[model samples]
Target: MVAITNTTSLTFLKDELDATLSQAESALEVFSEDTSRSGELKVCAEAFHQVRGICQILELPAAALMAEEMELVAEAIGRSVTPERMVGTLGNAIVLLGRYLEYVQLKNAAMPELLVGGINELRRSAGKPLIAESHFFRVDVTRERQPPAAPASTPRTDVTRLCRRMRHMYQVGLLGVLRGESRTSLKLVSRALARIDRLCGDAPMGRLWWVARAAVEALLADEMRLTPARKQLLSQFDRQIKRLVYEGERALESDAPLLLVKESVYLVSLATQDQGLIGEVKRAFSVRPRFTDGALQEELSLMSGAGGSVIRTVATALKEELNDIKSTLDMAAQGAADTDYGDLADTLVRLAGTLVMIGQSREAAQIRGRADQVRQWRNGEVDPEGMDFHALVDDLLMVENAVATLERRFAPADDINREVRNTRISLYQLDEARMTVVGECRAGISLTKRSLTSFIDSQGDRMHLSNVPSVLVGVSGGLMFLELDRARAILEGCRQYIEQSMLTGSGAPVREQMETLADAITSIDYYLESMEEHKPIGDAVLEVAEESLAELGYPVMRAPQPA
Candidate 1:
């Protein structure tokens, strides 16, 4: 009678399981080039025999039964392994082993539908040319499988301890490679691999091989190698090892591994006669979600980082440019012909237009139309009767000068702060243009209003007003209103700038300046509106005008109107 101690039997069973898995993988590798059905069947027979031995010793009746079925198929193929019959039998054997391993790990007797479907697919491909024109190989099964039930649970704990020890050893070996101790590390890995092979035998050797390959590649990656063939071989080894790691890692997951195993089985069925499994393997792992139009758009929007700050930055710049254009118009209204300033104004407008074009806004199209009009005026295209040519010319010249100054400030590409400085300069030019526009508009508003009032009084309220008076009034009012709108827009823009600056801890000075300008514009708008509505004529107008002048820090008193 053979006496089997619990500890000894458990150790032997664990070792057998490892040996079986390693042998199974090795058999697959060896048979990968065996085009003959008989050769492939023989390979399967050897693999199943190993699995059956492990299962029977471990007392896993279910696994043993599955192995028996696989053995039968292998035997059948061994008799007269025709391409069609051998492919089907081999594919089925792979699927059965994979499923049995998965079931053992998960302890779920009910096979997964995917597993069943995969088996069916392999069976369907039997006796046909490999569907994917690739061969099949197996990975280590026991390294990823659950331990057999033990009364004391000691064996289970030991298995976990051993796996963890191996993982740590592998990690250290990689560190050795990083430190340029390749030969030492390789020796250490070889010893570790040998120990694992001894402990688990041939079954779990695939895992050891993977760990060894990874260690070798890590060392090779840092080496200065001159041989092309050596480099190519190392590269291939690196890719294969990494792929194996990925698959093995995923297989550790109870459900995920089962799915992969099933897919692999199906692939083997279809491509058993082929010499490579690259295409089939890639297709199996390349599953991705199908995106709808809305989903795609949402994804794109997310990619763009579409948000309030981006919108405001663009809007603020645009508003500033429009204000600059208004400032030029104000100068024109005053009969001022500062063409140098005009060029700067035009350039600012163009830059603003460009920013608007890039920003996400429904109003972008309208701004674009206005930009076209500005462009036409700059190019001597249309002379609309009331269009302010002097202002337009001044704006163009000022814009050009501003752009030239920016061009000078921009450093070469190699400059460390070139991009940052360029953005700053562009922003500074924009700020200057904005302030100039606001200042001119503020000064010209009073003058234009006064001139209009004088003309109205000279003609009297009853004097036949031409259609042009309303048009002029409308244009003047429109310009004033537009300037006010721009100011408000700038105020909103400033808020965004301040928030962003606070978050990023940079650009504080620019943000502060914007906030101050925004506050000043708000005050100006309040005073101006009061004057326009409640006091369009005499003392009331004078009172509000004084308040507005004070707000603007202008000490000059209003000229008394003729009674």
Candidate 2:
């Protein structure tokens, strides 16, 4: 696995790396302007070479590989290749790398797998064979793996014929997958792999089949996307089947391909489903949940879009321009001779072009049409109260509303934060009830903590903690009202601990037990606070509370699984 540690040396090099990337982009732009300046290509290559060295020094394998591919693209351009065809790839690489660095700095950890798509794009542009998506995915292929049980019925006498039939089954499913019939087709593929696993039981090749089975389960669960690279990986599995059909039963004893096993294990790790074989694989590999493919793509979309700061700036400028246009339209409506409809027409045309550039195609078209009408009006005698003039003013007002909406949509982050901070309790009955319950829960948790603290201080006095059970019961009731089942469950466990352990046990609670109970209470308090603030309540908090409750020997029941 690629480590995400950010060292002092990496931090120190970040600014210089950004400057070098900028220099490379500028040189590429210059070279695009005049191809004869082959020297600019050399400059670009040298910059990328520096970037590769820096990434290598930092032990950023993926980033170093990206820089190497970028250098290759630059050199390819120097060798009389068309710069236009490759500049976009190079430009995207530069921008994406910068954004990724910012992402790492902000998140305090790197997920280099997220950069695979961009890296592959650079490699493709450099005419290099694409790397597997699981290139960074690590797993021990040589580890012992148990295969699925063999069929209880009579064994197949002709192994080659049986294997060939299974291969055919796999091919049919592969066709469905290739044709985009994923959900059903994935089952067929998985079923075929299941048969193969049973056939290869206790053989070295069975591990590959086992992993592939889980990988397909992941795909079927929609944990991963059917990307081009993954499609190729699936195709490679067909060759594995052919090996078994052609080479006889001994082929089952052949060692599984290391890269293939790693990729399959990687897919299993991405799976959200934790049931049966997939769950078994995760436990064996000690895999933890990371970003699913869908979540990763969403993050990439946000990073690639115009930054909030830039959007807010553009929105501000657009509103100012809209105000100017509105003022001119107002003057025209009032029969002001200095209205200068022709000049207004020019301004509207420019505004429309800006709208188009900002991805507001419909708005651009409307503005452009209005501008054309104003151009015609400039040549005619004007009537201040004319329907034509009135309609133009109304349209301008509509456009003003759109500009206002855009401004709000892209409001500055600080302004949004301030607004949230200033938000007052709603007078609506449902919201008021929810907040009231949350407040009650918070106070109850506080009381429970104080009672527990006093009980610990008193060295086993039931009098100090007598009311904790009732207080916890009230909190659990309030949590149920708020529809927070998880928190209520934790509180239920806490109530049990107070009633059964601290109140009735022969001795005072141990220090570890007291701390664990305290931790559970604090987690619920935090949950209630988050609820009142209208912030998202993450599952991690519930997990912490649940784990603490379990440590206290009064574990809450697991939440109900979704149907």
Candidate 3:
């Protein structure tokens, strides 16, 4: 019944998912104490409730059931039940729900034993006392399983041996569960905890030991269901065990604090119960192939077909861009209407792509950033009667020098445009402060127009109420720079459009209206810039400005006569 009818739905869902993860992470921190108990329960309950709705929309009832169990677990803990009794089970359930969502064949529904027994197991663990002190038998770890052992709050020996032993059982068991060896995995988890109980004695490790033991018992009672979530949880348990063992071994070698090892052992035994460790475990590491030599060879072979030296070929291409830049610079200095360097931004980006082909990814990234800076420089301000292009030109020259030096070329650029160099020094003296203000204002408005156009195109029909604030903010920011009051009146229409889009699942149904307002703003920008430059607005721009200004209920636009 919860249908994602539009693109905005997924965006909203991702936001909700982000919030749930955040709350769960917070609950993980203080879920242990009675003091933070109520607060933790509230966050967990809210997250679970949100997750339930998402799962329902995706038709994942099993995942939903898992979330519901956690909600109930938190409620149980709120009313005097122990946190150790419920933490592991709830953490395990979250892992399962995540796996269910990442599904190959998402099911309509299924009531599994794991879901049914989770709450019951928590109640049973919460009611059970610390094991009797006499159960701390010194049995060999290889021996078969035994019944419940006694517990005590007394640490008698070093936990090193126990940590090493736990390391093995937890890892092997974690692997076993992943490969569907459920009984063996549960048995190993149980064995590891038993060893912890024997070694930890009366220390805080016993409480964590019980938490671990309870987790194993819960799985055994529910038959250790082979869900992806269960496997992931066990994997996390395995990683923590490995960390615990490694830390123990180092501690033993360095004669470090034995308490450190005991603390680690306790945490390992508790696994996902701690939240932060579980988060680390959830971060899957991967190896993505990058620019290996073979890839570089392939690129070399392709570009080599252009016939000249590779460095020369690349340099030649770069020089061509410089030539075009010089002309744009001249036009900018002359205050030409067509002095936009949007093409220059595109050129630099394309040049960076060529660097990528040569396995110069680092350089490519740097070049791309430099390209972005070009737009950033032009963002709020533009240089009309363009100021000196020396800084931009020098940056390009440095790239050429680095490349030529790497290639061991001694000769300088044979084709470097000296015509650009001839008057470049004199050009920087132009007092274009007034020209800059007018040009920048026009360029800012123009860029904003393009931004709106791009937004409407990309959002398609999935726009929602949430998107309006971004647009309104952007509009206000740009127009405020120019003292335009029209931005406020137009905002009401934006609000109405957002409300309607939510109902109809159509983004900005009155897009033309928005576009017209943008055009009007741009026309005003162009008119002001032309006036400041001591030139007449062209008839083409004047007529469009006249119509747009009148449409937006602004003052009439009369074309300024030639000076």
Best by TM-score: 2
What Cα-based lDDT does every candidate model obtain? 0.39, 0.73, 0.47
Model 1 worst lDDT window (10 residues): 411-420
Q: Candidate 3 on 1-563: residue-level lDDT in tens?
A: 11223334444565566568567856855776455656777888888888878766755444565566666666776676345646776665565545334321232222222233333443344553222111111122221112333543322333554466455545545554554545634555565565555555444334444444544554554353344534544555455445445564343223212332332232233222323322221121111122222332333333222345776677667657666766776676666665456777788788788777755676667667777867655532565434335556655555544443433342321111111233233222222443454455555555545655665676643432345445545555544544343333343333344345433554454543454454444444444543443332322333443344444444452335569
For residues 515-545, write the lDDT of model 1, one tens digit per residue. Answer: 2223333333333332222211112212222
Predicted structure 3: clash tally: 8
RMSD in Å for all candidates:
31.2, 18.3, 32.2
Query: Best-fitting candidate, measured by lDDT?
Result: 2
Score candidate 1 by lDDT: 0.39
After superposition, the stretches of candidate 3 with alpha carbons farther than 4 Å from their true spots are 1-157, 243-563
- Superposed by TM-score, candidate 2 places the C-alpha of residue 253 at a distance from the truth, in angstroms, of 2.5
Candidate 3 weakest ten by summed lDDT: 132-141
Candidate 2 all-Cα RMSD: 18.3
TM-score, per-candidate, Cα-based = 0.20, 0.52, 0.21
Ranking by lDDT: 2, 3, 1
Error of 3 at 141 (Å): 30
